[model samples]
Target: MIGLAPIFSYDDQLKRFLLEDVGSGDVTTRSVFSYEARHRKASAKIIAESDGVFCGGPFGSRILSYSDPMAKFEAIPDGQPYAKGECLVAMEGALESLLLCERVILNLLKHLSGISSLTASYVEMVRLLRKSSRSLRITGTRKT
Candidate 1:
């Protein structure tokens, strides 16, 4: 079925993210680029600075939408593995909007992908051990 990326209900929280990150204004951006920057179209790839499994696609999409309604971001879907320097997220939109959301989106992707990669490693280890011990089972306990 075809469906648009549903605008998550956590828009307020997302707005807070923008506010916290931007504050009064993007001083560096303002000082660095001309007012013409806002009118320019731009594109970027969120490359994997290190090898990992990708995660946080939905959240990254939300951040893009929250930053600019017309902006678009794409990743190879969550839980997919990507090699170092591979494009994890691709975005295109107004130059200003793209730059504005860049760091936050990358930070979320990196953090979530890091966890996913770590979990994959653990799964691989457990599977290897389980081959020799059929009764072995992975168990997890959580505070929540």
Candidate 2:
């Protein structure tokens, strides 16, 4: 809940990201999964590979929703701390939809969580170094 941008703000970018990954359709998934198989429901979880300040669950949910409206996405609340092997996001939906969106979702979560973890470490370091100054602020540049 840390000042997340409006979901609309990401519409174009999200479309572009999905398009980039799913260009010309997911031929492999389409070829491999029969109509009945594609419709079969399945569950998946994105598990943390290391401890960090977790981020991007909401975004991942949004991505899944975009890919398949019927899909259910449950995300660990953003900005929370999670340990290695913890579930960061849980999704239930058609197996085909899950397969299609998996890589993109994982890539996004990894990038965002890395930033969140690094920023948390910096903040913690500052907090420990200056216990008296309550006004010290940590800011970042526009560079990503």
Candidate 3:
């Protein structure tokens, strides 16, 4: 879909994010997994830390794939409501690869969820207020 095309197109941005967080390879993960670790498979689930809207499923998938092409990922559909501790992403791949991409994927999920959650709250608040006055609406101001 067009939604996913943008993610793949922004190679520099994704690489920058990884480079900023993980530089010259992840020493910690590398130390734990040896060169032969690519054959090892590991599975992990991303759990929500707080209640919010799930808004980064696709982003998470893309980030993981970018970090490790062999990493298998499954993320919940975006723009849906989720409760705290809900599983947002399920990934199974090489242990080292999973560890390397974990932080970036989680960070993206957290950021997107925060924005969607706030927007959802504001919409709910407006809905409640709108019930009292159907004529009241949120509108953009334009100057002629």
Instruction: Identify the candidate with maximal TM-score.
Output: 2
- Decoy 3 TM-score against native: 0.83
Question: lDDT tens digits, residues 63-136, model 2?
Answer: 88877898999988889999999988889998888988888889888999999999999999889768876667
Q: How would you encode candidate 1's per-residue C-alpha lDDT over 1-144 as one tens digit per residue?
A: 267765565677666777788776667877888989864889999877888898998887888786688887778988888898888888888887887888878777788888989999988888998889866666788757
> lDDT of model 3 at residue 113?
88
Q: Per-residue lDDT tens digits of candidate 3, residues 102-133?
A: 89888878888899899889888889989988
| Candidate 3 residue pairs that clash | none
Cα shift from native, residue 67, model 3 (Å): 2.9
What's model 2's overall lDDT?
Answer: 0.86
Cα displacement (angstroms), candidate 1, residue 87, comes to 0.9
Q: Which residue ranges in model 1 land beyond 4 Å of their true spot?
A: 1-10
**Ranking 2 against 3 by lDDT, winner:** 2
- The TM-score obtained by model 2 is 0.86
The top-ranked prediction according to lDDT is 2
Off by over 4 Å in 2: 1-8, 132-136
